[model samples]
Target: MPPSRNYMTERLPSPQLLLRINTLRDRALAADSLNALAFSMANDAYSLLQYHQALVLALQGEQAELLCVSGLAKPAEDSPYLVWLKRAGRWLNQQLDGNQPVWLARADLDPPADINDGWAEWWPAGLWCVPLHNRAGQRLGLVLFLLDAPPPAPLPELLSSLWQTWSYCWQALDSKRRLPRWNASRSKLLIGLGVLLLLLLIPVRQTVLAPAEIVSREAQIISSPIDGVIKQMHVRPNQQVETGSLLFTLDETTLRNRAEVLSKGVAVADAELLAASQRAFDNPQSKGELTLLNGRAQQSRAELAAVKAQLARTQVHAPKAGIAVYSDPNDWLGKPVSTGERILQVADPAQPAMRIQLAVADAIALEPGAKVTLFLTAYPLTPLHGEVLETSYQAHPSDEGVSSYRLLASIEGEPENARLGLHGTAKLYGERVLLGYYLLRRPLAAVRAWTGW
Candidate 1:
């Protein structure tokens, strides 16, 4: 058999204990309406537990103040209970480490000394101190009930359970007050990521855009056949001419004079030869003289023939059908040209190409057949398309005093209204690549060059 049980040690709640617990739970659940909830909890606790008063002191960071008061019609700031609460707050914070409710019985304060303004003398016979904490273990505040007698065991346990749930609601209210509604840094980070993704997905042509000009695809240069002074001009600068058209005539005054002189010399030699032949027929010793006279005549005739040929070539003719590409015609009218010296160019206007001078700094690796589009200064609204045919192996200084490489591009077809020497800009398209790579290629190249990395 079991020993006789000690019923006095295990106290039970009264019949109305469940009703009081339910009422407190309802108040705690409505903690979002904090002021009303605090008042309701305080009044209900006072009436249900038969306490002298109920008080809720809210604590936020380092601040502590009375939230609500019950069981007093005219509660004053100088009230002993409030004064005692203010004085004991620091001690209460240190003792409520685990956030468990502190059940203070009448026997516990027997030897208590005076507190703030001697408010310790007004201490209740028994009290319940429930320290409220959120689920994360952050202290919300403290709830105090001034007890007329020790509360039933179930009442303190029930209040502790209700406050635990109420702690969450209080936390929500605190967060709403302390935390920002929108975070600028978070928003900025999202925007930056979106821009990066957009840039990666978008595509653009990887092209090297440079200035260009329209030029003859293939030109024929006319040069002087012999050293002579220009005596006559048959064509104007930039004028179109057909094959065999006389282009220019060199001075022929001295040439004609030399030819006439040589002719007279030949005539004199022939007369001498005839006389020598007659003598040779009369005397055998005169045969050598005939041979000498004949040789002299032959030499004079050869010299005369050469002079006539020179006179004929004095009038230069067009080699092919094309425009006379030269500066002012007056520049050549009285000019003396050396043998093989270039006089002008005959370029077919129908066949046009692009000549580009790419700066060394702006140059990129290029392959044959690169597509190029030209926008002429004279026709900005029009564009001419072509393909790269050749590129210089080395760079040369341009008129602008910058080192550049020259490239030749053939037009896809004969462009309407296009002419030789038409100047414009060109865009040379290269292999496809990412937009970021295309944009940063130059800057990265510069950095590498500067750092030698």
Candidate 2:
């Protein structure tokens, strides 16, 4: 005998099962909403199949939603089974294998494969997966029938027919209430076309964007030679001063007093030595005292000369002709600074370069002579072009506390208005790439980081 005949003869649906399926079909036809339709269908399947749970899942975009659940303790949306159901539904919808419904039993599936094993813990013994479709033969959704015992031989064929009838009823009712819409196939095709157009037409630049500031190439820093308070500032900030001009001066009162004290000590020691020398001529015993006094006088003279040199150094002078680059001289006035502390910088206005701080997340492989374009905050309309001079190998924290790599770029041509300390945005260009890759590069990198790929 043929398999179909043998299956039907062995396990035909009981009269009660037939009656329940008829009732379910009538209810599905009369269902007002998609939710009501799914619930009625699941209820009928649970009653006839003697299943522990029955779930109806519908696919929307990249996700699947639990439309209705029967034999569940709580609402379908709040059930733990909902999570697994949605996950399983997505995979099932994407499957390209044969469309035949699956009847899985624990005995038959000793070592379950694919999605069957995933839900094995919950279903444990046996279950049936019935795929539903619309009139156009497009996959609409799936109906999951989970049972504690293995189903009858003909149960798969019967349940498949019943689920098909339920789908037809849902379609008839839904069509009357709603207008026609594109199926999954049509929507996917449209999206593919849109993506293709974007890839062909869109122009995306592979760039490393960073915060840049105008810096002087031949900048000379003026540091505090000695720890002292500033008494007076001679040149104003950004002022063009010649070499040897007094840039600033420290309070010389203490230094002068120290010098004076040293000088007095030196004079006294010299007088003592002269007296000792005269005594040595009269008494030979004074010769040892004369040597001691002479040594003391030389030490005092050396100390005094050193104090005088320090006193002269109290007045700081400009090293070379350049503009004084400082914010406010008043802030530095009376401020006691430590030795080697930066007081100010003298930068040549003629030589300017762009200093870029590239964020760690935004860093890319950079090489010397790579093109860089800077859009100054001051001059938004104008863009100054440059080329990369060098990039720091190590990453360090920026003033904002974000780790970043430093890049130095030499401006191609001098922009007349660009000045030192001008802030701007810099775009460092790298190798050309497809528009799709350029757009998805960061997002893909983030995904890779999250997944530890």
Candidate 3:
């Protein structure tokens, strides 16, 4: 019907060719399934190893191991790699004690030459050891993986992502274990003993007396004297300055000009005085002229001196040695300033002091020269010795609706670095009451006031 197809143009496949394609397809499918299974197993093993590593590290143990289904032999004890592992174990222990994560790299591992010889060809060169922590966050052991050469690439990625699961599992196991229970019991027992000791020592503290701190005068705010364009600023914010030292200079062009004019006027006045005296000696009638010249010379000299004195005020000098604190300029630059506009403040570091606002009732009990302890927020450990220098007699209403008196205290032996405006607590040592009263006074007062009891 198709005009008979030519034998040379048509072709047919032999049965052997069909069989070969089917066989190749079967092999490919099998290989894929095997790879997937191997990857899954590797991931599981890695997770377990990580957990064990963490446990050993937390315990400060010198050894850790990750056992697998393959029944790999333990590393040789004498091997350098083994030594490295021991070091890592020690590091892990330290980290755990410090409550930090145990992170060890391939460089941390000491391996036997032959140990990796078998797997060297199959695995990456550099391996990492990750510690696994139990539910109690205790080190379990380690998870090992070859970083340089990963198996199938995807396997390593999968293992790394799933490694956290091992930590969770181990942590659960630790929680269910008996070791934690024993530790907790021991801790409670120690706490109970401590409480008993504290109760017994209460009376002993009453017998011993400590040197009382004396409250001193509060620091005063040092304000700037003059305002002008700050030509030369010598000190920075909080920089210590000395008395008579140059703090800064104002634009003194106007003053400099006045000084120059006064200097010329003084020279002219001196010549006129000399000439007038010579003429008075030469002629009797010149006496009147000489007297007039003398008066004019004296007036010119006085004016010149006054102008020079005014010029000296242009250079800003420190009034006292202290720290320099700059005030906000408020967008003013080279602008003229009022007579008392502050440019900077110098706080005396050596004479550190603090001001406290106390309730009027508390202030009534506080007397001048009373001892007090100052505890700055910045230096909580170091209590500053202080004495009550002064207390305001008048009670003023505070923003908090409380009538308070300002109490000034001079801090003794302050550190060189202490700055102004540092907030601190001042504990005033009121008249020495019974040791028992001193200890419970604050709490009792608060309770009495709160409960109206």
Candidate 4:
């Protein structure tokens, strides 16, 4: 509660105290570090003052961390005595100034009950505190010595001179301890970061990968002309065929059965009309009925003709000479198809083009006539190059189940080397952008999607 006791105005110490002060001065000067000097002041240096147990602590952040204790190599921080000592150290750190030393008893501290309860159990009398200050007058740490009895004459004068001797060496070690650890790597780190930034700024062409296949530039889609189950496939995928060739046929059993029923009804109508004509000559009532029978007979013939025409359409034929492109014939053998459902493609194998399905998420602004590179799974070594001819404005679900934009690219030079229906990976190039943008585009897009930014 009171200011630190002032001992500077006291008379000079006697000869015996002078020799003791000089002995302590030699030990402080020879000390190598703050920890070593603190240890000596708590242990061997106790001859300068009468004290029992002692503690050496460093001020680290808001806590007084134990460094050493008298008669022990390491301080037992978990022990009840040290735990109570730490609580008392916190109160002392807040109240004491580094200007002078102070003697603290139980009433002087009036610490919290937790710290107060264990003080009498650990020490017999009062505690003496000496704060260590750097050259800048900042409190570095403190030393606590437990004393049961009063120190002999001239103890204050001797302790004041001893503090001056220890502070000089403590300041030198404290300065070195506070320096930056990575002094050697700072220049190398700065150079690496600068180089990385420049590399990111370099301009590069933006590209995207999409599944592609070699197809005809002008191909004909062969769709089902009637609603029926496919009975057979006459042409296979990539098979050569000519005009008027049977491409495929639907199930004719249902149409054939309908035609047979219509034919029998037509014959019965003609027989009834003949019988009514004969009766018309005998009775006037029969002549009126003869006209009705003739109309009925004509209607039956029309129905038969319609059924026959449907039967003719069951067998489909190729309209042009080209190769047929479709999947496994077994997949369509018993599958029911609707009218206008596409079954296969009739393409000219020599005039190959690229059909690329670019996913909507990976889509970039691509102009017509943009460069395209195709690496076929079969012919990976010989990459075929092409130019974009068309790109769909809207996205459609592809076979891969992802929404994609369909792209058609025209093959450069002769396309005879490549065949239709060959699958590959296409590399489509767009306008130039910063290398950083090209590399980080997907990651940045994912982050935006996650953050909704």
Global local distance difference test of model 3: 0.54
**lDDT string, candidate 4, 1-453, tens digits:** 123334543555667768877887788778787677777777876666667887877887779877778888776658877777788788878878647887788866677777777777777668777888877788778888888655665677567878877777677766677866775587899898999999999999999999998888868999999999999999887899999999999999988998999999999999999999998888889988887999998999999998898889999999999999888899999999999999998888778899999998999999998999999899888889989999999999999799999999988888445877789999999999999999999999999999999
The ten-residue window of minimal lDDT in model 3 covers: 204-213
Off by over 4 Å in 1: 1-204, 394-403, 434-437, 440-453
Worst lDDT window (10 residues) for model 1? Answer: 111-120
| Candidate 3 residue spans exceeding 4 A from truth | 1-232, 267-284, 319-321, 325-347, 359-362, 369-375, 378-385, 395-404, 410-419, 427-453
Question: Where in model 2 is the C-alpha error above 4 Å?
Answer: 1-181, 184-205
TM-score of 3: 0.39
Tens digits of lDDT, candidate 3, 28-123 = 334333222223333434332332211122233565442321222333666655555555445434444432223333344554454334334433
Assess candidate 2 and give its lDDT: 0.80
Arrange candidates by TM-score, descending.
2, 4, 1, 3
Predicted candidate 2 versus true structure: per-residue lDDT over 158-266, tens digit per residue: 6566677777866666567677775668789999999897775567557977899998888999988887889988989899988999999888888889888988999
lDDT agreement with native, every candidate: 0.79, 0.80, 0.54, 0.85
lDDT of 4: 0.85
Which of 1 and 2 is ahead in TM-score?
2
Candidate 1's residue-wise lDDT over 1-453, tens digit each? 223344543565565766767767776676666665667667876656677777777886766677788855445888766766665665556655577777666565443354423434665666777887777787888877777576766666766667766676667666666757665697898998999978976677688877787778768999998889998788988899999999999999999999989999999999999888888877999998887888999999999999999999999999899988888778888898999999988888888788999998888778889888898899989888878999999999987888999999988765784788778889888877788878888999999999999
Who wins the TM-score comparison? 2
Residue pairs that clash (backbone atoms under 3 angstroms), model 2: none
TM-score of 2: 0.58
